[model samples]
Target: MFKMLNQMLNRTLQRVSLFLLSVILMACAGTQSPNQVTVTGGTIEGSLTPQLAVFKGIPFAAPPVGDLRWRPPQPVTPWQGVKQTTDYGNDCMQLPFPSDAAPLGKTPAEDCLYANVWAPKDADGTTPVLVWIYGGGFVNGGSSPEVYDGSKFAQQGVVFVSFNYRLGRFGFFAHPALTDEAQENGDMLGNYAYMDQIAALKWVHNNISSFGGDPDNVTIMGESAGGGSVLAMMQAEQARGLFDRAIIMSGGGRSLFGDRKVSEATQESLSGEQYGLNYAEKHGITGTDAEALAALRALDAETVVDGLNLAAMFNPAQTNKPTWAGGPMQDGELITQTISDALQQGNLADVDVMVGATSMDIGGNPFKDKDALFASFGEYAEQARKVYDPSGQAPFQVVGYAVGQDRTMQEPARYIAEQMTSHGQQAYYYRFGTVAQSSDNPGAPHASDIPFFFDTVAEKYGDALTQQDQAAASAIHQYIVSFAKTGKPVSDNAAQWQVFAPEQSNMLNMTRNGDMQHGTDPWKARLDVVKAAVESSN
Candidate 1:
C-alpha cells in the first residue's frame, strides 16, 4: 500500500536565510515539546505564532545561484539542532507588482527555495497535514498577511504548511545551453519551482510524522498558480502517493490538454537576452554569456530588484507564443504529460476530492456595464446564443460570462467530480454564491468563498452576517473537514450521495442560509455549453 514512499531520498545542498519580518517567536511552556530552543535552520531564527511551536526552515535544496541556476532542485541537508523559522522568508525574485503603489511588506530574491510549516498545538500524533502553495501566476507570490496561518486549521486539529519557490524568469527558464548537462532523470532543465514543491512534499513525508502529523495522511491544496501546481503534482509519477486528497480553487490548469510541445516562439526570451544585455550596458556592466550571467548573478540584491514584469515572466523564455503563455512546459519526468493526458490515461492517484469555483468569477466586474457586456455576450457568442439567443437581447452575455466562468472553473470541477464518482471514488462539489455584505458592499467575489471554505469567514474580518452566513459557513466547513478525515463530504446524512454522471446533470449547491440542494443543476447546461465552446476555438 505504501508503494511510493521511497521517492523521498533526494539530493542535498545548503544556503543561509534572508528573512524580512521581525519574526515574533513564541512558545508556551506547558506544551509537550516545550523548552528546546534555537533550532538551527537555513532561513530565519525565531518561532511563529498560532501553533506556537518553533519551526526550522530546512533547505529542500541549495540556492540555485550559479551553475545550479535554472536547473532542477537538489535535496536539503539534514542538519543538527533546531533551525529557527520565525520570520517570513524572501519571496521568489521577480518584477515589481502593480500593488507597488501601496506595498504591504518585503519583495523577493533569487535564493528563494523555502518552505514554512505549522506544528501542532497539541501532542496528538494524528493531526492531518495540509500543505499550501500560493498563487501569483507562477511568478510573484509568498505566504503573507497570514492568509495561510495554520492556527484556525490547527484549531480544528490539522497541521498547515505554506512556502516560497522560484518565480518569473529566474524559475522556469529553459535553454539549449542548459539541456546538455542532463541528469539521468530524462527531464529537461528549469521548472525549479516545481522541483521545490516536490522536494518540500518529500520533506513532509519524511519529517511531518515527527511533528504530530500522520505521514500517511496528507492533503495537497492551493489556489491559482498554486492550484495549477496541485494539478501538476496530481499528474506526476514521482508525486504519486504523496497526497491523499486535493482541493483546487479558482484554477483550471490553463487548458494544456493535448498541446505540449516546445514552440519556436521563444522569441520573448531571445528578446529578453537582448534586453538583459542592453540593460547591463545602460548600467555600465560588462559581460559575455557567462559574463552576462555573472553580471546578473553579481548585481547586489537591491540592484537586481527587477523592475516591472511584462509577458510570462515565469518561463519567459518559452512563453512567447500564445499557446504556451501562462502555461507550464510538459517536460517528461517531472510532468510526464498534460493534465488532459493524465485524465485520458487515468493516471491521477485514486484520492478523494473537494473542488469548486465562485459565481462572481473574474469577468463579473466587466459584466456590470452594457458595452462590455455586448462585447463579450453579444449576438456572436455561443453561451449568449445558447441562453439569451431565444430572447435576441444582449442580457444573455451575463450568461456567457457566467458560462465562461463555468468553463474556466465549474466544468472542470464537474469533470473531476464526475470522473471520481465514476471510479467509485468519493467526491464533493460546492458553489460559492453567497453575497456577504461587508462594511460597505457585497462580499466574496471570485475567491470570496475561500474564507468560508476554509471556515475563516469571520476570521477574515467578516462580521456577523445574517444567520444565513453562519449556517452556510458551518455546513461548508463541516463538509470540508469531513472530506479531509474520511475522503467523503456529506451533509449530516446516512444517504450515500447520488453519484454524478455526464447524463445526470446533478450537483450540490450550498446557499447563503446553509441549505443544501441537489438535483438537475443549471450549471449542467452551462457546463455542456462551456465544454462545447472550449472545445471549439474562439
Candidate 2:
C-alpha cells in the first residue's frame, strides 16, 4: 500500500511539472517577438506563435481611475511608441474572488480599462472579428484569463479581442453621491461597466479593420456576465451596429436588470460608513463626517479588500444574498429597463446569435432534497421544486440549481430565440451537456463549454484529460473557429447545428457521447412565470 501511494505521488508530481512546463512554454512563446504592423495608422506590436500574431495589452480606452472611476469609458489616448503588446492589463476594480470565481493571477487595481487583440500572423486585412467579455458575476474577472487567449482564434484567421470593465461596487454601485443633477448627459446612472463594454465595442468597430479584421462583421462573445452583456448590447439601440453576430457561453444573465442593485448600494454605503467609523477609531482620525468617505478611499487596497469581499458576500448577486439583492441595476442609462423586455419588443441588435448555458453554472448548490432547495429560495421555493423534482436519489439542491440555471440562462437564451423567430430573424441555441470525464458530475457543468469552445482542453484543463479528451477538444475548437470565421459554427467533424425558428426550434445539445437533437423549447413554462412577474407589477 505504501509503494502504491508512492507511485501515485510520483505520477502527480510528473503531471504537475508537465503542466508548469506547458504554461512556461506558452508564456515564452507569447513573448518570443514578431514583426510590427500598422492598423489605422497606429502601430500595434505583436508576437509570433505557432500560427498566430498575438497582441497583448492594447489600450482601447483610457484607464478609468481617479477622476474616471465611476465615469463611462473614455477614448484611448494614442501613444507614439509601439506600446509593447505582451502583458495583460489590470482587471477593472472589483471585489476579491474566492467563492464565486476561480483563481487567476492577481491584478487587483483601479486603472483597468484596457484591451488586447489577436489576428492572423499572415492574413489579409479583412477577417471577421470576435470580441470576448469575461465573466465573474459582474464583480470579478477580466479579459486576461488564460482560457480566453486569442492566439488560437487568430491562427484560424479571425481577429479576437478582449477587454476589461469594472466589476462589483466599482462597476455597478450608484449612490446619490455620484448621481447628482450635474452628471445627466446620458451617463447619469450606474452600470458604468456596461458603458465600458459599449465603448470597447465602439473602439473595435472603428479600429478592427486595421488589424486585418472586418469591422462590418464583428461578433461579440463571452461567458457569463460577458454573455449577459451581449444580450444587453443587443437590446440597446445605441449599440445596434457595433457587432453583427454574437456567441454566448454559460450566459449566467437570465435578466438584464438585477433587482437588488440599488438596495445593495444603500447597504454598501451604510456598511462603508460603519467601517470608516471603526477605522477612524483605530487611527487618530477626526469625526465621522464626509471625511470618512475620503478616508475609506484612501485606505490601502489590501486593507479594504477583505472588507469588500465580506460586503460582496452580503450582495444578492453573489449567490448567498437574498434573491432580490444586488445585481445589474435597471438604470435607464446603462441598461434599457430590462433585456427581457427589450427582446420581447423589437428593440435589439439585428444580428445572428448563438447562445447557450452549461448544465450547472459556477454555483455548486447541493440539491440534497426539496426542503433544502425551498429553504434556500423563499416564496419561489415551491415553483422551483415543481419544475425540478429533486426527490430522486440525487439531491434536490442539484435539481433546484438546474431549474435556477434555466431561469438564469437556458430560458433567456431560448427566449431570445423565441423573440428572434417572432421577428423573422434566424437564431441558434445550444445546451452543452458534456460532463468532464474527470468527475462523475452532471450534464455540461458551468464553464465546461469554454475549453471546448476555445479548443484549449490541453492548454487550460489538461490534468484530468487523456487521449479521448484531446480529440474532443480538437473537434469543439474547430466548431467555434469555423463559426467565428463564418456565420455558421458547423464543421464536417462536429455536430450539425440548426438555426432556431418558431416552426422548428431545432438546436444542438452537445454531450460527451455526441451532439443530439434539442429543438424543443426548454423554457416555455419558466417564461410564463417571468411574464407574470413583469405583468403583475407588484
RMSD of each: 12.0, 12.5
Residues 407-449, model 1: lDDT tens digits: 5677776777666666666666656666554423232366556
How far in Å is the alpha carbon of 379 misplaced in model 2? 14
The C-alpha local distance difference test score for the whole of candidate 2 amounts to 0.65
Q: Which stretches of candidate 2 lie over 4 Å from their true place?
A: 1-34, 38-42, 99-102, 181-186, 252-254, 259-306, 309-325, 362-395, 514-538
Off by over 4 Å in 1: 1-32, 35-58, 77-81, 95-106, 183-188, 257-327, 363-384, 396-400, 439-444, 462-471, 490-501, 512-516, 533-538
Best by lDDT: 2
**How many Å off is the CA of 538 in candidate 1?**
13
Candidate models: Cα lDDT each: 0.58, 0.65
TM-score of 2: 0.77
The C-alpha TM-scores of every prediction are: 0.75, 0.77
- Per-residue alpha-carbon lDDT of model 2 for 1-538, expressed as tens digits? 9999999999999999999998799566653235565543356677777677777777777777655655777777767846667788787665656754344554768788777888786656678888988877676788766677777777777888988887765666544434542155446446677888888888888877666788888888888777887777887666878888888776644456643343234433332223223434444555534354455346555443334543365452432222212346756544655666666677777787787777565443555656765555455656645555635555655566665665566666677777877876777787777665775775666776777777666666667776666666676667677777777877665667777765555667766654444556555555455434434443
Least well predicted 10-residue stretch by lDDT in candidate 2: 316-325
